[model samples]
Target: MTEAGDDTWLARNRATLARLQFAPQARSVGRVEHVADGIALVSGLPEVRLNELLRFETGQLGFALTLDVEAIGVVLLDQSESICAGARVSGTGEVVRTPVGQGLLGRVVDPLGRPLDRDEALGETVFMPVERAAPAIIERDPVSEPLATGILLIDALFAIGRGQRELIIGDRATGKTSIAVDTIVNQKDSDVICVYVAIGQRATAVQRVIDAVRRHGAPERCVFVVAPAAAPAGLQWIAPFAGMTIAEYFRDQGRHALLVIDDLTRHAATHRELALLTREPPGREAYPGDIFYLHARLLERAAKLSGELGGGSVTALPIAETDAGNLSAYIPTNLISITDGQIVLDAGLFAANQRPAVDVGLSVSRVGGKAQTAALRHASGRLRLDYSQFQELEMFTRFGGITDARISAQIVRGQRIRALIRQARFAPLPESVEVALLGALADGLFDALPPACIATARERLLAGAISGDEAAAVRARLDGIVQDLTREAGHRPSDGASAP
Candidate 1:
C-alpha cells in the first residue's frame, strides 16, 4: 500500500510539471534611443499606444507622450539619471493611471500614483487613466445646485454652482490659494470630495497646505496630489490630470467632488518646456500652439452628470496667477475664456486689506441667480449695484465733503456691507449661519454698530453652541428669525426722507 501511494504522488507531481512547461510568454521589450532631461526617446515600441506606460530594463518608468514615425518620446515619471542611450525598455501596454478610492483621501501622492506620505503602499483601489474624454452634452444636466464657499460676498453675488468651472485669477501673494483652502475647509462634514493639486510648488509650501488641511479636520475628505517645484517638468505637467482623474472616479461613484488646481500657470509653463524639448513649434508666449487645448481638454471633463448616469458632479476651481494684475495676459485670458466665469482679485482692493479681495464689478457667475438659495437671492439683490454706486461716489467725495445727507447714508451702508464681506482665514461659515448674518445685515442689525466690530459679531453669531435634543429645535428657531428678517428686508422700502 505504501509503494502504490508513493507512485501515485510521483505521477501527480509529474503532471503538474508538464502543465507549467506551456504557459503564455511575457511582454515584448524595446530599446531606448536616448535619455535627457526627464525624457527618453525609445525605438522598438511601435506597438505602444499614446500615453501608454513604459518600463525600462533597469526598473524605471516613463509615459509615452508623443508617437513619431521613427521613435516615441516618453516622459520619465521618476528620476532619469540612471537611464541611458540604447537601454532596453518594455511596454506595460497601459496608459498612465492613478488610484482612486476613500483610501486616497488623507494621503499624499505624486502624478504617477506613487504614495509619498507613508513607507508602505496603499491598500488596493481602483485605478483610472489620467486622461479621459469629457461627457457628451446628452450626458450632462444643467448646474443648479449651489456650491457654497462660505464666503459672504462670493455666495451672495458670484455663486459657484455645482459642476461649474470657476477661474480664480489674481496676482501672486494676492491670496488666491487662500480662497481655495477656505473652500476646501468648508467641505468638512459635507459629502463633497476635495482634491487639491499642487504643481511646481515648493515642498514647504505644499507642506503648509497639508498642515492647514489637517488642522481644519478635512483630511478624511481631501486628497493632496503634489508635484513639487524640484520635480521634473513632466511630473508637474501631469499632476493635475492625475488629480482630476481621481476626482472623476469619485464622481462616477455617485459622489460630488471639488477639484482645485492651485495654479495652472505653472502647468502651462511645464508643458511649454516639454514642447520645446520635443522640437514642437512654439506659439505665443513660447508655449505650444495647443496651449489653449491643453487646458480645454482637461477642464471640459468637469460636468454634472444626468440622473440616469448616477447624478454625480465634479466642479473645477482652477487658479491662474497674473502679472501686475493683467487679466489680458495669454494664460489668464485663455483660462477666463475656458471657465464658466472668473473671480478677479483686485490688487488695489487687496492692498486696502480687503480680505478675500473679490472685485464685484469684475467677478460674475454666468450661472448666476439660479445657483443661489432663496435666502441668498433675496438678501443679495441690488447689493452689487448699491456697492458699485457707492464706490463711484466715494471717489468723487474725496475732493469735497458730502453736501447731501443722502450721499452720506449711502457711504455708511456701503461701508457696513464691505465690513460684512471681510472673513478671517480658516473660519468658513456654515450655510445656516451665513444666511442668518446676511439676513441680519439686510435688516439693519449692524447699522449702528461700528464697522470694525462687525467681524467679531459675525464670528460669535456662527460659533455659538447649542447641543443635544434641543439643537435641531434651536437651529430651526434661528433659521426662522433669519427667514423673517430676510423677508422683511426684501419687502422693506427705502426711506426717501433726508436728514439735515
Candidate 2:
C-alpha cells in the first residue's frame, strides 16, 4: 500500500477500536476480612505473594506483608480508617517500587517517592523495587578512599571510608542527628550525592534538618526521604529501604552517594508495631526476629563496586539511639556488630560542652588509617593516643594532686586538641585547614598560646590559608603560615617546627 493509504488505514482502525467497549481481564480479587491500625487481613487471593502491592476499593494502597494459608496480612500505606471489612482488594502482580533517578535530587519525598516539599512532579524517573539484593562480595572492592565527615574528630581519628557503614549511636538529645547533618553539609563541595532518610522523626525536627542542609550544604546534591512520626507505619518501615534504592541509582551510574538513616530505633519501633498489628510473634525486646536481618539487608546494599562495575560507591551512616548510654542494649549492640564501626557519642561529654560529643575511647573505625588521607594520617598518627592519655590524666588531676612537668605539659596539649576539635554546627573545615591544625599541634606550636586562643587562631588560619587545590604546595607552606600566626599572636613558634 502507498504510505498515505497505510496511514489512513491505521487511523481508521484506531478510531474504530476507540469506540468499542472492552472488559478488563479477570484478576484475582480478594475481600478484606479484618482491618485495624493500618493493617488488614484479606481472603480469597491465594496467589498473592510477599511484598506485593494490593489495591483497595477505597483507592488506598497496601503490601502483602505476611501470606498465610487462609489470608494475607496487608500493611496499608494510607489511612486505615477509610478501609473496612469486605472491601475489595486486588493484587497488583508487582512488588512495591519507588521512583529513582537524578530527578529526585534536592527533592523531599516520602517512602513511596511522592514529593512532599513542593507541588511539582518528579521529572523522568525509573521505578525500582525498594527491596533489592545486595552486591555480592566479588562485585565489591575494598574500601580505601576516605569519606571526610569534615568533623576533625572523625576525619582525624575515626576515619570513615567510601562504601563503609558507620553507626552513630548515643542516648537521646546527644547530637546524633547533628553529626549526620554536619556530614551532609560538608558534602557541599564534593561530588558525593547525599540521601538523608528521616524514619519516624518529628515533623519539626525533620524540617530543621532540611533547613540546615539548605543553608549550609548543596541542597541540589541532596535527596531527603522522610517518614515522619505521623506517617503510616508501613511508610516508616520502608523509609530507609526506599532511600537506599534512590541512592543506589546514582551509585550504579558511577557516582558516589551517601545514605544517612537519621535514626533506625524508631524504625524498629514501627516494625514492631506493624508486626504486632499483623500478629507476628515478637522476640527480643518485643521486636520481631527479622529486625536484624531487615537492617543488614538494607545496609549491605551500600558497597564500593569493583572496577568492572564502574567503581562507584555508597557510604552509609546509620544512626541508632541508646537508652541511658547503654551500649549493651539490644538494638545498639546489633548495629555495633553490623557496621564497620560505631561513633559513640557520650552524653556526659555532650553536657560538658563538647559539641560533637564523640567519645574517643569508645568510638572506633575498623577502616582505621587505611581510609585516612596521606596528609591526615601522617599528621594525626599519635593524636588519638595522646588525647586518650590526656583524658585519663586530667581525670586524676581533678583531685588536685601534684603532677610532674611532663604530665602538666601533656594535659595542656590535650586541652588544646580538645579545643581545636570542638567545631560549630554548620562549619566544616577543609582538609588543608585540618592538616595545618593537626601539624601545628604535633609540632607544639599551640603550646605557647593559651587554650582560649586556639579557637581564634583556628579562625585566622582558615580565613588566611591558601586553596587546597595544590596539596603539596599547601603542605609546604603550612609551617610558615603557622609560624606567622603564632608570631602575630605574640607567642614564639616552636623551634624548628615542620609542616605535615
Candidate 3:
C-alpha cells in the first residue's frame, strides 16, 4: 500500500467494474475515484496505475478505473454498496515478479513479467519490483574484471568487462542482434545468466531469436522478454525496465547477470511518444527535456555492486540501430557518452564481406584497460601500432610491383593477421586456444599458409595441437620462410648461405 502525499491527484467517476483482476494489469484502465488537486480516489483503489497495481489480486469486491487520471489516485464503483456517493481509492506503485529457483528458464514473457502463454500458469512466486531508482555511488564497484564473450577478436581487442554498460551501435543489418544472441549462447559455462529484452520488434523476429537461443541449449540460463509490435505502446516503454528488474533479482542473490536490450532506439521513440501524449515539453527531436534523465536513470541501474552489498553484477550490452548510419544523432551521441564504451559497427566494411565488419580504426573500447588482464595487454600491445602502419602502406602496394621485399613481406604478414581476426560461427574458444591463436599471429605464424588455409590453421589451433609458447617459435620461423619466398619471387640473389 502506498501512503498518500500532501497533494495527490484523484478522480471521481461512477462506473461498473469492466473485468475481474488484481490491481496491476498491463494496459488496463480503471474507473476514476474522488478527484483532489493531485490525489484522486475511487473507493478501494491503489495509488499507482491500475496495470501496475493489479499485481495483487485481492478477492475483495470493489470498483475499477480504466484511464490514468494524469495525476494520482483512482475511483472505484461498488454496485452492491451504496458508497457510490464518493469514496477514496489508493494505488501501490509496484510490479509483479517471478521467483528465482528452478523452472523459470524456457519461458516467454510480456512487459508485465507475466507469461504470455496462458496454457502454463506461473505458480505463486515472489514479486519483483520494476520501477527502481538509479544505484547510489556507494553501491557501485569499479569495473575491473573482464567478461570474455568467447569471440576471439572481441576478447583480444575491446574487451567487455562484467558489470560494464556497453553500447553496440550500428546501422541496420550489421549483425548486432546476432552478436548479442551469440554472446548469450556462448555464456553457458560462464555461470552468467542472460536476459534478452525485445522491444517493439516483429513477432517473427522474436520467435526466431527464441528458437536460436533454445537451439543452443541455453534456455535454462536465458530469460527472454518480448513487447510485440501490437502490444500497447506503454509496454514498449516499460519492457527494458521490467527485464532489468528480473536481472537484478539474480544479481542481488550474488549471481552474474547479462542483460541485452535489443534496440533502445525504439524504446526511446516510444517514450517520446508517451511523453508527448502526456503533454510534456518536447526538446530535441521531439523528445522530452528529461530525455537524458530518462535514459541515464535506466542505464545507471546496471552496476557491479560491492561484495558487502551483493557481489553479483550486471553487464549490459544495449544495442542501438542508427538511422542512416548516423552517429551524430541525438540518441546515439547521448548513449555513447553515457556508456563505458561502444562497439561501432561499420556498414561500409560490412558490405565488403567482412563478417563482424568491425572498423578496427573507428571501433574503440574506452574502458578496455579496466577489462584487459596484464598478460593480455602485454601480449597484444603492439597490435594497434602494427595494424595502423600496415594499412597506411597497403594502397601503394596494391598498384603491383612498387614495393620492396621487406615492405611486401610486412603486407603478407598483416594480411594474415586481418584474416585471423575474421570471426567464425558462435563457438566458445578456450583461453588457451585464444592465447595460442593470437600469440602465433603476433609472431607471424600464418604468413606461410595460403590465405585459403587460414580456416584450417585456426581449426588446428582450436584443436590444441600447438601450445602457446611454441606458437611464437613456429610463427617466427614461418615468417622467415615467407620473407625468403618473397625474395625468391624477384629472383634476388641470396645474401646468406642456404641452410643444410
Model 2 earns a TM-score of: 0.93
lDDT leaderboard ranking = 2, 1, 3
In order, the Cα lDDT scores of the candidates are: 0.84, 0.89, 0.68
- Per-residue lDDT value at 157 in model 1: 85
TM-score of each: 0.90, 0.93, 0.76
Highest TM-score model number: 2
Please list the residue runs of candidate 2 whose C-alpha ends up more than 4 Å from where it truly belongs after superposition. Answer: 1-11, 14-25, 469-493, 496-500
Stretches of model 3 off by over 4 angstroms after superposition: 1-103, 395-401, 404-406, 463-500
How many residue pairs clash per model? Answer: 0, 0, 42
| Tens-digit lDDT track of model 3 for 394-447 | 866776774477777767766766777777656666555566566656555555
lDDT string, candidate 1, 1-500, tens digits = 99999999999999999888677876677888888988888888678998788889889888887889898889888889889898899998788888888778788998877889987777657888888999999999999999998787888889998899999998988889999998998888688999999999989989999999899848988889999999977789889999999999988888899999988999998998888877778989898889999899999999999999998999999999999988898998999999999998988989999999988888888998788888778867777897898889889999999979889988988887888888888888766666666665665655655666667666555656332223234344544443444345553322322221
Error of 3 at 201 (Å): 1.1
At residue 43, candidate 2 shows an lDDT of 99
- For candidate 2, write residues 1-500 as lDDT tens digits: 69999999999999999999999877788999999888999999998889999999999999999988888999999888888899999999999899999899899999899999999999879999999999999999999999999898899999999999999999999999999999999999899999999998999999999999999999999999999999999999889999999999999999999999988899888989998888899999999999999888988999999999999999999999999999998889888888999999999999999889999999999998999989899989799998999899999999996458778878888888899889888878888778877877887777776677778877765666655545445545656665676688787776744222
The candidate that wins on lDDT is 2
